[model samples]
Target: MTTGNFPRCNCASGALLQGVELAPGLPALQCPACDGSVLKLDDYRSWQPAPAAVTQPPHVPEIEDRPSARSCPACGRLMQRHRVGSSPDFRVDHCAPCQLVWLDRGEWPALAQAGLAGRLAEILTERWQRRLQNDEIRQQREAALRGKHGDACLDELARIRTWLAEQPHRDELIALLRTGW
Candidate 1:
Protein backbone atom coordinates (compact mmCIF):
# COMPACT_ATOMS: atom_id res chain seq x y z
CA MET A 1 0.00 0.00 0.00
CA THR A 2 1.42 3.39 -1.07
CA THR A 3 0.14 6.93 -0.77
CA GLY A 4 1.55 9.93 -2.61
CA ASN A 5 5.38 9.70 -2.46
CA PHE A 6 5.18 7.67 0.76
CA PRO A 7 5.78 3.95 0.40
CA ARG A 8 3.81 2.01 3.00
CA CYS A 9 5.61 -0.32 5.38
CA ASN A 10 4.45 -3.92 5.15
CA CYS A 11 5.29 -4.58 8.78
CA ALA A 12 2.66 -2.14 9.91
CA SER A 13 -0.03 -0.37 7.98
CA GLY A 14 -0.44 3.40 8.33
CA ALA A 15 3.25 3.71 9.09
CA LEU A 16 4.62 6.78 7.37
CA LEU A 17 7.61 6.16 5.13
CA GLN A 18 10.33 8.77 5.34
CA GLY A 19 13.20 9.37 2.95
CA VAL A 20 16.56 8.58 4.56
CA GLU A 21 20.13 8.91 3.39
CA LEU A 22 21.89 5.64 4.14
CA ALA A 23 25.16 6.93 2.69
CA PRO A 24 26.41 10.14 1.13
CA GLY A 25 24.27 9.97 -2.00
CA LEU A 26 22.21 6.82 -1.47
CA PRO A 27 18.60 7.42 -0.55
CA ALA A 28 16.21 4.88 0.97
CA LEU A 29 12.68 4.79 2.17
CA GLN A 30 12.46 4.15 5.89
CA CYS A 31 9.52 3.48 8.13
CA PRO A 32 10.02 5.29 11.37
CA ALA A 33 6.99 3.55 12.77
CA CYS A 34 8.54 0.04 12.64
CA ASP A 35 12.17 0.72 11.66
CA GLY A 36 11.82 -1.23 8.40
CA SER A 37 13.46 0.08 5.21
CA VAL A 38 12.93 -0.16 1.46
CA LEU A 39 15.96 0.23 -0.78
CA LYS A 40 16.18 0.10 -4.54
CA LEU A 41 18.70 -2.37 -5.92
CA ASP A 42 20.51 0.28 -7.91
CA ASP A 43 20.71 2.52 -4.85
CA TYR A 44 21.96 -0.19 -2.54
CA ARG A 45 24.34 -1.59 -5.15
CA SER A 46 26.15 1.72 -5.34
CA TRP A 47 27.95 0.84 -2.10
CA GLN A 48 29.33 -2.42 -3.47
CA PRO A 49 32.95 -3.10 -2.49
CA ALA A 50 35.64 -5.22 -4.06
CA PRO A 51 35.29 -8.95 -3.48
CA ALA A 52 37.09 -10.08 -0.35
CA ALA A 53 39.84 -12.67 -0.63
CA VAL A 54 38.73 -16.13 0.42
CA THR A 55 41.51 -17.71 2.53
CA GLN A 56 39.80 -21.04 3.12
CA PRO A 57 36.64 -22.86 2.11
CA PRO A 58 33.49 -20.80 1.76
CA HIS A 59 31.21 -20.71 4.77
CA VAL A 60 27.78 -22.14 3.93
CA PRO A 61 24.84 -20.22 5.33
CA GLU A 62 22.39 -22.18 7.50
CA ILE A 63 18.98 -21.76 5.83
CA GLU A 64 15.85 -22.17 7.91
CA ASP A 65 12.29 -22.93 6.80
CA ARG A 66 10.77 -19.48 6.94
CA PRO A 67 7.25 -19.39 5.49
CA SER A 68 6.35 -15.73 5.55
CA ALA A 69 7.13 -13.43 2.61
CA ARG A 70 6.77 -9.69 2.52
CA SER A 71 5.17 -7.57 -0.22
CA CYS A 72 7.18 -5.11 -2.24
CA PRO A 73 6.43 -1.52 -1.48
CA ALA A 74 7.06 -0.46 -5.05
CA CYS A 75 4.80 -2.98 -6.77
CA GLY A 76 2.71 -4.68 -4.09
CA ARG A 77 4.06 -7.99 -5.34
CA LEU A 78 5.25 -10.75 -3.05
CA MET A 79 8.99 -10.27 -2.56
CA GLN A 80 11.50 -13.08 -2.79
CA ARG A 81 12.99 -14.15 0.52
CA HIS A 82 16.73 -14.49 1.02
CA ARG A 83 18.95 -15.46 3.93
CA VAL A 84 21.74 -13.03 4.74
CA GLY A 85 24.68 -15.19 5.81
CA SER A 86 25.21 -18.21 8.09
CA SER A 87 22.24 -17.31 10.22
CA PRO A 88 18.93 -18.77 9.08
CA ASP A 89 16.86 -16.73 11.46
CA PHE A 90 17.14 -13.41 9.62
CA ARG A 91 15.80 -12.89 6.09
CA VAL A 92 15.33 -9.96 3.72
CA ASP A 93 12.91 -9.51 0.82
CA HIS A 94 13.69 -8.56 -2.76
CA CYS A 95 11.45 -7.79 -5.72
CA ALA A 96 13.47 -8.63 -8.79
CA PRO A 97 11.20 -7.04 -11.35
CA CYS A 98 10.85 -3.89 -9.33
CA GLN A 99 14.45 -3.98 -8.21
CA LEU A 100 13.42 -3.12 -4.69
CA VAL A 101 14.58 -4.65 -1.42
CA TRP A 102 12.79 -4.65 1.87
CA LEU A 103 14.63 -4.97 5.16
CA ASP A 104 12.78 -5.68 8.35
CA ARG A 105 13.69 -4.08 11.61
CA GLY A 106 17.35 -4.69 12.54
CA GLU A 107 18.13 -6.54 9.29
CA TRP A 108 20.30 -3.72 7.94
CA PRO A 109 22.37 -3.63 11.12
CA ALA A 110 22.65 -7.41 11.09
CA LEU A 111 23.95 -7.38 7.50
CA ALA A 112 26.49 -4.69 8.37
CA GLN A 113 27.63 -6.62 11.46
CA ALA A 114 28.14 -9.76 9.34
CA GLY A 115 30.27 -7.76 6.84
CA LEU A 116 27.83 -8.59 4.06
CA ALA A 117 26.49 -5.10 3.37
CA GLY A 118 29.09 -4.17 0.75
CA ARG A 119 29.58 -7.63 -0.77
CA LEU A 120 26.08 -8.74 -1.63
CA ALA A 121 26.55 -8.58 -5.42
CA GLU A 122 29.87 -10.41 -5.23
CA ILE A 123 28.25 -13.32 -3.42
CA LEU A 124 25.82 -13.86 -6.31
CA THR A 125 28.41 -13.88 -9.08
CA GLU A 126 29.98 -16.67 -11.15
CA ARG A 127 33.06 -16.59 -8.92
CA TRP A 128 30.97 -17.58 -5.96
CA GLN A 129 29.44 -20.44 -7.92
CA ARG A 130 32.89 -21.67 -8.92
CA ARG A 131 34.03 -21.49 -5.32
CA LEU A 132 31.08 -23.63 -4.24
CA GLN A 133 31.92 -26.23 -6.89
CA ASN A 134 35.55 -26.28 -5.77
CA ASP A 135 34.50 -26.74 -2.16
CA GLU A 136 32.31 -29.71 -3.13
CA ILE A 137 35.15 -31.26 -5.07
CA ARG A 138 37.53 -30.83 -2.15
CA GLN A 139 35.06 -32.44 0.25
CA GLN A 140 34.53 -35.39 -2.07
CA ARG A 141 38.25 -35.83 -2.54
CA GLU A 142 38.82 -35.81 1.23
CA ALA A 143 36.11 -38.41 1.80
CA ALA A 144 37.50 -40.68 -0.91
CA LEU A 145 41.06 -40.34 0.42
CA ARG A 146 39.93 -41.16 3.96
CA GLY A 147 37.97 -44.19 2.79
CA LYS A 148 40.78 -45.67 0.66
CA HIS A 149 43.83 -44.76 2.74
CA GLY A 150 42.38 -44.83 6.27
CA ASP A 151 42.80 -42.00 8.83
CA ALA A 152 46.49 -42.55 9.64
CA CYS A 153 47.70 -42.66 6.04
CA LEU A 154 45.40 -39.82 5.04
CA ASP A 155 46.67 -37.65 7.89
CA GLU A 156 50.29 -38.39 6.96
CA LEU A 157 49.61 -37.60 3.31
CA ALA A 158 47.96 -34.33 4.29
CA ARG A 159 51.01 -33.37 6.39
CA ILE A 160 53.31 -34.26 3.49
CA ARG A 161 51.22 -32.24 1.07
CA THR A 162 51.26 -29.27 3.44
CA TRP A 163 55.04 -29.40 3.61
CA LEU A 164 55.28 -29.79 -0.16
CA ALA A 165 53.00 -26.83 -0.70
CA GLU A 166 55.29 -24.69 1.44
CA GLN A 167 58.35 -25.64 -0.60
CA PRO A 168 59.56 -23.34 -3.40
CA HIS A 169 59.81 -26.38 -5.75
CA ARG A 170 56.22 -27.50 -5.07
CA ASP A 171 55.35 -27.63 -8.79
CA GLU A 172 58.49 -29.67 -9.55
CA LEU A 173 57.75 -32.05 -6.67
CA ILE A 174 54.17 -32.51 -7.91
CA ALA A 175 55.38 -33.12 -11.45
CA LEU A 176 57.92 -35.66 -10.32
CA LEU A 177 55.35 -37.51 -8.15
CA ARG A 178 52.92 -37.64 -11.10
CA THR A 179 55.68 -39.33 -13.20
CA GLY A 180 55.88 -42.12 -10.52
CA TRP A 181 59.14 -40.76 -9.00
Candidate 2:
Protein backbone atom coordinates (compact mmCIF):
# COMPACT_ATOMS: atom_id res chain seq x y z
CA MET A 1 0.00 0.00 0.00
CA THR A 2 2.88 2.33 0.74
CA THR A 3 5.24 3.56 -1.98
CA GLY A 4 8.31 3.11 0.20
CA ASN A 5 10.83 0.35 0.66
CA PHE A 6 9.48 -2.82 2.26
CA PRO A 7 11.05 -6.10 3.23
CA ARG A 8 10.00 -9.04 1.11
CA CYS A 9 10.97 -12.67 0.79
CA ASN A 10 12.82 -13.86 -2.25
CA CYS A 11 10.51 -16.26 -4.00
CA ALA A 12 13.40 -18.37 -5.24
CA SER A 13 15.15 -18.35 -1.89
CA GLY A 14 13.69 -17.76 1.54
CA ALA A 15 15.84 -14.69 1.98
CA LEU A 16 14.26 -11.48 3.22
CA LEU A 17 14.82 -8.62 0.77
CA GLN A 18 13.86 -5.04 0.18
CA GLY A 19 11.47 -3.97 -2.54
CA VAL A 20 9.56 -0.92 -3.77
CA GLU A 21 6.16 -0.63 -5.37
CA LEU A 22 5.09 2.05 -7.80
CA ALA A 23 1.43 1.44 -7.15
CA PRO A 24 -0.98 -0.81 -5.32
CA GLY A 25 -2.63 -4.03 -6.57
CA LEU A 26 0.17 -4.70 -9.08
CA PRO A 27 1.53 -8.22 -9.02
CA ALA A 28 4.97 -7.24 -10.26
CA LEU A 29 7.68 -6.06 -7.87
CA GLN A 30 11.31 -5.12 -8.19
CA CYS A 31 14.09 -5.06 -5.63
CA PRO A 32 15.35 -1.68 -4.55
CA ALA A 33 19.13 -2.06 -4.72
CA CYS A 34 19.86 -5.66 -5.66
CA ASP A 35 17.29 -5.59 -8.50
CA GLY A 36 16.28 -9.12 -7.62
CA SER A 37 12.93 -10.65 -6.85
CA VAL A 38 11.49 -9.40 -3.61
CA LEU A 39 9.43 -11.95 -1.79
CA LYS A 40 6.15 -10.79 -0.35
CA LEU A 41 5.25 -11.12 3.34
CA ASP A 42 1.86 -12.37 2.31
CA ASP A 43 3.50 -15.24 0.50
CA TYR A 44 5.61 -16.07 3.52
CA ARG A 45 2.65 -15.75 5.84
CA SER A 46 0.59 -17.98 3.64
CA TRP A 47 3.35 -20.50 3.68
CA GLN A 48 3.40 -20.33 7.45
CA PRO A 49 -0.38 -20.72 7.68
CA ALA A 50 -0.25 -23.88 5.63
CA PRO A 51 -3.68 -24.04 4.10
CA ALA A 52 -5.23 -27.48 3.71
CA ALA A 53 -4.38 -29.27 0.49
CA VAL A 54 -7.17 -28.89 -2.00
CA THR A 55 -7.79 -30.50 -5.31
CA GLN A 56 -5.57 -28.93 -7.94
CA PRO A 57 -7.15 -27.38 -10.97
CA PRO A 58 -6.49 -28.80 -14.40
CA HIS A 59 -3.12 -27.80 -15.76
CA VAL A 60 -3.15 -25.45 -18.73
CA PRO A 61 -0.11 -24.78 -20.83
CA GLU A 62 0.66 -21.12 -21.47
CA ILE A 63 1.93 -21.55 -25.02
CA GLU A 64 0.99 -24.13 -27.61
CA ASP A 65 3.34 -25.91 -30.01
CA ARG A 66 0.99 -25.70 -32.96
CA PRO A 67 -0.31 -22.31 -34.07
CA SER A 68 -3.94 -21.61 -33.28
CA ALA A 69 -6.24 -20.38 -36.02
CA ARG A 70 -8.31 -18.70 -33.30
CA SER A 71 -8.62 -14.95 -32.92
CA CYS A 72 -5.44 -13.00 -32.29
CA PRO A 73 -4.82 -10.81 -29.28
CA ALA A 74 -4.63 -7.78 -31.58
CA CYS A 75 -7.45 -8.45 -33.96
CA GLY A 76 -10.54 -10.39 -32.95
CA ARG A 77 -10.52 -12.67 -36.02
CA LEU A 78 -8.68 -15.86 -36.88
CA MET A 79 -4.94 -15.44 -37.17
CA GLN A 80 -3.52 -16.60 -40.47
CA ARG A 81 0.00 -17.89 -40.89
CA HIS A 82 2.11 -15.60 -43.01
CA ARG A 83 5.76 -14.92 -43.64
CA VAL A 84 6.28 -11.50 -42.08
CA GLY A 85 9.06 -10.42 -44.41
CA SER A 86 11.61 -11.80 -46.84
CA SER A 87 12.13 -14.95 -44.83
CA PRO A 88 9.89 -17.65 -46.24
CA ASP A 89 10.82 -20.12 -43.53
CA PHE A 90 9.80 -17.70 -40.79
CA ARG A 91 6.08 -17.91 -40.14
CA VAL A 92 3.83 -16.12 -37.65
CA ASP A 93 0.18 -15.91 -36.73
CA HIS A 94 -1.56 -12.82 -38.01
CA CYS A 95 -4.63 -11.16 -36.40
CA ALA A 96 -5.08 -13.46 -33.41
CA PRO A 97 -4.55 -12.00 -29.94
CA CYS A 98 -5.75 -8.56 -31.00
CA GLN A 99 -2.66 -7.00 -32.55
CA LEU A 100 -0.51 -9.45 -30.66
CA VAL A 101 1.31 -11.58 -33.21
CA TRP A 102 3.33 -14.60 -32.27
CA LEU A 103 6.63 -15.59 -33.86
CA ASP A 104 7.23 -19.28 -33.68
CA ARG A 105 10.24 -21.37 -34.79
CA GLY A 106 11.68 -18.32 -36.55
CA GLU A 107 13.42 -15.44 -34.88
CA TRP A 108 14.84 -13.80 -38.00
CA PRO A 109 11.56 -12.57 -39.44
CA ALA A 110 10.49 -11.38 -36.02
CA LEU A 111 13.66 -9.35 -35.70
CA ALA A 112 13.21 -8.07 -39.25
CA GLN A 113 9.84 -6.48 -38.49
CA ALA A 114 11.49 -4.64 -35.63
CA GLY A 115 12.97 -2.39 -38.35
CA LEU A 116 9.51 -1.39 -39.48
CA ALA A 117 7.45 1.40 -37.91
CA GLY A 118 5.28 -1.25 -36.28
CA ARG A 119 7.96 -1.95 -33.71
CA LEU A 120 8.12 1.72 -32.75
CA ALA A 121 4.36 1.80 -32.36
CA GLU A 122 4.46 -1.27 -30.14
CA ILE A 123 7.23 0.20 -28.00
CA LEU A 124 5.43 3.50 -27.58
CA THR A 125 2.21 1.75 -26.70
CA GLU A 126 4.01 -0.41 -24.11
CA ARG A 127 5.74 2.60 -22.60
CA TRP A 128 2.45 4.45 -22.32
CA GLN A 129 0.86 1.41 -20.67
CA ARG A 130 3.68 1.15 -18.15
CA ARG A 131 3.26 4.78 -17.11
CA LEU A 132 -0.37 4.19 -16.13
CA GLN A 133 0.32 3.39 -12.49
CA ASN A 134 -2.44 5.56 -11.06
CA ASP A 135 0.12 8.31 -10.57
CA GLU A 136 -1.71 11.39 -11.79
CA ILE A 137 1.46 13.37 -12.44
CA ARG A 138 3.17 10.62 -14.39
CA GLN A 139 -0.04 9.80 -16.26
CA GLN A 140 -0.53 13.44 -17.20
CA ARG A 141 3.03 13.81 -18.40
CA GLU A 142 2.76 10.68 -20.51
CA ALA A 143 -0.56 11.83 -21.94
CA ALA A 144 0.97 15.19 -22.86
CA LEU A 145 3.85 13.50 -24.65
CA ARG A 146 1.49 11.12 -26.44
CA GLY A 147 -0.61 14.03 -27.67
CA LYS A 148 2.44 15.87 -29.01
CA HIS A 149 3.63 12.90 -31.04
CA GLY A 150 2.18 10.97 -33.91
CA ASP A 151 3.33 7.56 -35.14
CA ALA A 152 6.41 9.20 -36.67
CA CYS A 153 7.46 10.46 -33.25
CA LEU A 154 8.04 6.97 -31.94
CA ASP A 155 11.80 6.47 -32.25
CA GLU A 156 13.17 3.00 -32.96
CA LEU A 157 16.17 4.19 -34.92
CA ALA A 158 18.75 1.96 -33.28
CA ARG A 159 16.46 -1.09 -33.19
CA ILE A 160 15.43 -0.40 -36.77
CA ARG A 161 19.05 -0.22 -37.85
CA THR A 162 19.91 -3.49 -36.13
CA TRP A 163 16.87 -5.19 -37.53
CA LEU A 164 17.48 -3.85 -41.02
CA ALA A 165 21.02 -5.17 -40.91
CA GLU A 166 19.73 -8.63 -40.16
CA GLN A 167 17.00 -8.37 -42.76
CA PRO A 168 17.38 -9.14 -46.48
CA HIS A 169 16.58 -5.59 -47.67
CA ARG A 170 19.31 -4.04 -45.57
CA ASP A 171 21.11 -2.77 -48.67
CA GLU A 172 17.91 -1.54 -50.23
CA LEU A 173 16.89 0.44 -47.14
CA ILE A 174 20.38 1.85 -46.88
CA ALA A 175 20.22 2.89 -50.53
CA LEU A 176 16.89 4.56 -49.85
CA LEU A 177 18.54 6.46 -47.02
CA ARG A 178 21.18 7.72 -49.45
CA THR A 179 18.41 9.05 -51.69
CA GLY A 180 16.91 10.93 -48.70
CA TRP A 181 13.52 9.24 -48.32
Candidate 3:
Protein backbone atom coordinates (compact mmCIF):
# COMPACT_ATOMS: atom_id res chain seq x y z
CA MET A 1 0.00 0.00 0.00
CA THR A 2 2.86 2.35 -0.88
CA THR A 3 2.58 5.08 -3.46
CA GLY A 4 5.16 5.78 -6.11
CA ASN A 5 5.47 6.40 -9.82
CA PHE A 6 5.60 3.08 -11.62
CA PRO A 7 6.01 1.92 -15.16
CA ARG A 8 2.76 1.72 -17.13
CA CYS A 9 1.60 0.40 -20.43
CA ASN A 10 2.60 2.94 -23.00
CA CYS A 11 -0.68 2.09 -24.66
CA ALA A 12 -2.63 3.39 -21.68
CA SER A 13 -2.00 7.07 -22.38
CA GLY A 14 -0.92 8.15 -18.92
CA ALA A 15 -3.48 6.45 -16.74
CA LEU A 16 -3.04 6.50 -12.97
CA LEU A 17 -2.58 3.00 -11.60
CA GLN A 18 -2.34 1.00 -8.38
CA GLY A 19 -0.01 -1.79 -7.38
CA VAL A 20 -0.93 -5.07 -5.73
CA GLU A 21 1.54 -7.13 -3.76
CA LEU A 22 0.74 -10.63 -4.87
CA ALA A 23 3.09 -12.54 -2.57
CA PRO A 24 5.29 -11.85 0.42
CA GLY A 25 8.00 -10.27 -1.68
CA LEU A 26 6.45 -9.96 -5.13
CA PRO A 27 4.65 -6.74 -6.00
CA ALA A 28 3.44 -5.44 -9.33
CA LEU A 29 1.60 -2.49 -10.77
CA GLN A 30 -1.64 -2.79 -12.67
CA CYS A 31 -2.41 -0.09 -15.15
CA PRO A 32 -5.96 1.11 -14.88
CA ALA A 33 -6.10 2.21 -18.51
CA CYS A 34 -4.75 -0.93 -20.17
CA ASP A 35 -4.49 -3.32 -17.24
CA GLY A 36 -0.84 -3.91 -18.03
CA SER A 37 1.24 -5.39 -15.25
CA VAL A 38 4.93 -5.08 -14.34
CA LEU A 39 7.13 -6.17 -11.45
CA LYS A 40 7.70 -3.37 -9.01
CA LEU A 41 11.26 -3.02 -7.68
CA ASP A 42 13.41 -5.68 -9.37
CA ASP A 43 12.24 -4.65 -12.80
CA TYR A 44 12.57 -1.02 -11.87
CA ARG A 45 16.14 -1.40 -10.61
CA SER A 46 17.26 -3.36 -13.66
CA TRP A 47 16.72 -0.35 -15.87
CA GLN A 48 20.05 1.35 -16.74
CA PRO A 49 20.19 5.02 -17.46
CA ALA A 50 20.61 6.23 -20.98
CA PRO A 51 24.09 7.59 -21.69
CA ALA A 52 24.53 11.29 -21.58
CA ALA A 53 24.27 13.38 -24.72
CA VAL A 54 27.97 14.21 -24.68
CA THR A 55 30.92 11.84 -24.97
CA GLN A 56 30.43 8.23 -23.95
CA PRO A 57 32.69 5.34 -23.11
CA PRO A 58 33.32 2.46 -25.51
CA HIS A 59 30.57 0.18 -24.18
CA VAL A 60 27.98 2.98 -23.99
CA PRO A 61 26.82 5.42 -26.59
CA GLU A 62 24.74 8.52 -26.68
CA ILE A 63 21.16 7.94 -27.70
CA GLU A 64 19.62 9.87 -30.52
CA ASP A 65 18.19 13.26 -29.66
CA ARG A 66 14.44 13.07 -29.36
CA PRO A 67 11.93 15.34 -27.68
CA SER A 68 10.73 13.74 -24.49
CA ALA A 69 7.00 13.13 -24.37
CA ARG A 70 6.74 12.43 -20.65
CA SER A 71 8.69 12.89 -17.45
CA CYS A 72 10.20 9.99 -15.57
CA PRO A 73 7.95 8.69 -12.80
CA ALA A 74 10.78 8.09 -10.32
CA CYS A 75 12.97 11.16 -10.81
CA GLY A 76 10.81 13.67 -12.68
CA ARG A 77 13.70 14.24 -15.05
CA LEU A 78 13.17 14.35 -18.78
CA MET A 79 13.36 10.91 -20.32
CA GLN A 80 15.87 10.17 -23.05
CA ARG A 81 15.94 7.55 -25.76
CA HIS A 82 17.37 4.14 -24.84
CA ARG A 83 17.81 1.09 -27.04
CA VAL A 84 17.41 -2.35 -25.52
CA GLY A 85 19.96 -5.07 -26.35
CA SER A 86 20.72 -5.33 -30.06
CA SER A 87 17.37 -4.08 -31.29
CA PRO A 88 17.69 -0.66 -32.82
CA ASP A 89 13.96 -0.22 -33.07
CA PHE A 90 13.26 -1.21 -29.48
CA ARG A 91 13.78 2.14 -27.86
CA VAL A 92 12.38 3.65 -24.67
CA ASP A 93 12.84 6.89 -22.83
CA HIS A 94 15.06 6.44 -19.80
CA CYS A 95 16.20 8.73 -17.03
CA ALA A 96 19.97 8.82 -16.82
CA PRO A 97 20.11 9.75 -13.17
CA CYS A 98 17.38 7.60 -11.62
CA GLN A 99 17.28 4.70 -14.08
CA LEU A 100 13.56 5.12 -14.60
CA VAL A 101 11.96 4.24 -17.92
CA TRP A 102 9.07 6.20 -19.37
CA LEU A 103 7.05 4.61 -22.11
CA ASP A 104 5.04 6.87 -24.29
CA ARG A 105 1.28 6.57 -24.40
CA GLY A 106 0.33 3.17 -25.87
CA GLU A 107 3.91 1.94 -25.93
CA TRP A 108 3.57 -0.02 -22.71
CA PRO A 109 0.38 -1.86 -23.66
CA ALA A 110 1.68 -2.60 -27.12
CA LEU A 111 4.74 -4.13 -25.47
CA ALA A 112 3.29 -5.60 -22.26
CA GLN A 113 -0.45 -6.30 -22.64
CA ALA A 114 -0.36 -7.94 -26.06
CA GLY A 115 2.16 -10.44 -24.60
CA LEU A 116 4.47 -10.65 -27.62
CA ALA A 117 6.74 -7.77 -26.72
CA GLY A 118 6.62 -8.58 -23.05
CA ARG A 119 7.56 -12.20 -23.65
CA LEU A 120 10.41 -11.25 -25.91
CA ALA A 121 11.65 -8.71 -23.43
CA GLU A 122 11.41 -11.17 -20.57
CA ILE A 123 13.23 -13.88 -22.47
CA LEU A 124 15.98 -11.57 -23.60
CA THR A 125 16.37 -10.04 -20.21
CA GLU A 126 16.52 -13.43 -18.54
CA ARG A 127 19.08 -14.67 -21.01
CA TRP A 128 21.20 -11.63 -20.41
CA GLN A 129 20.86 -11.99 -16.67
CA ARG A 130 21.86 -15.66 -16.81
CA ARG A 131 24.82 -14.87 -18.98
CA LEU A 132 25.98 -12.24 -16.54
CA GLN A 133 25.55 -14.60 -13.63
CA ASN A 134 27.51 -17.28 -15.46
CA ASP A 135 30.27 -14.85 -16.21
CA GLU A 136 30.55 -13.91 -12.58
CA ILE A 137 30.62 -17.54 -11.54
CA ARG A 138 33.28 -18.32 -14.09
CA GLN A 139 35.40 -15.44 -12.92
CA GLN A 140 35.13 -16.56 -9.34
CA ARG A 141 36.05 -20.14 -10.23
CA GLU A 142 39.02 -18.93 -12.25
CA ALA A 143 40.22 -16.79 -9.39
CA ALA A 144 39.90 -19.65 -6.96
CA LEU A 145 41.63 -22.10 -9.25
CA ARG A 146 44.44 -19.66 -9.86
CA GLY A 147 44.92 -19.17 -6.14
CA LYS A 148 44.91 -22.88 -5.30
CA HIS A 149 46.75 -24.15 -8.35
CA GLY A 150 49.18 -22.30 -10.59
CA ASP A 151 48.67 -20.30 -13.76
CA ALA A 152 49.50 -23.42 -15.79
CA CYS A 153 46.23 -25.03 -14.70
CA LEU A 154 44.16 -21.89 -15.10
CA ASP A 155 43.43 -22.45 -18.81
CA GLU A 156 42.39 -26.05 -18.32
CA LEU A 157 40.18 -25.11 -15.37
CA ALA A 158 38.72 -22.27 -17.41
CA ARG A 159 37.56 -24.64 -20.15
CA ILE A 160 35.96 -26.96 -17.65
CA ARG A 161 34.51 -24.04 -15.77
CA THR A 162 32.95 -22.65 -18.92
CA TRP A 163 31.33 -26.00 -19.67
CA LEU A 164 30.06 -26.29 -16.12
CA ALA A 165 28.71 -22.79 -16.17
CA GLU A 166 26.79 -23.39 -19.40
CA GLN A 167 25.00 -26.44 -18.05
CA PRO A 168 21.28 -25.83 -17.86
CA HIS A 169 21.13 -27.72 -14.58
CA ARG A 170 23.76 -26.68 -12.05
CA ASP A 171 22.56 -28.93 -9.23
CA GLU A 172 24.60 -31.86 -10.50
CA LEU A 173 27.74 -29.78 -10.76
CA ILE A 174 27.13 -28.22 -7.36
CA ALA A 175 26.50 -31.61 -5.81
CA LEU A 176 29.61 -33.04 -7.47
CA LEU A 177 31.67 -30.19 -6.02
CA ARG A 178 30.08 -30.57 -2.62
CA THR A 179 31.14 -34.20 -2.70
CA GLY A 180 34.75 -33.17 -3.52
CA TRP A 181 34.70 -33.42 -7.29
Q: For every model shown, what is its TM-score relative to the native structure?
A: 0.59, 0.21, 0.32
Best by TM-score: 1
Q: What is the C-alpha local distance difference test score of candidate 2? A: 0.38
- Candidates in descending lDDT order: 1, 3, 2
Q: Candidate 1, residues 114-170: lDDT per residue as tens digits?
A: 666665555445575466567768988999989998999999988998999899999
Per-residue lDDT over 30-84 for candidate 2, one digit per residue giving the tens place of the 0 to 100 score: 4333333222334322332111111221332222224334333223456565533
Model 2 ranges off by over 4 Å: 1-77, 105-181
Query: Per-residue alpha-carbon lDDT of model 3 for 40-159, expressed as tens digits?
Result: 334544433232211222232233323445455555556555443333444555555654444433444344333333333343344654665677688788788888998878878667
Superposed Cα deviation of residue 16, candidate 2 (Å): 27
Off by over 4 Å in 1: 1-6, 47-67, 123-161, 167-181
lDDT of 2 at 164: 85
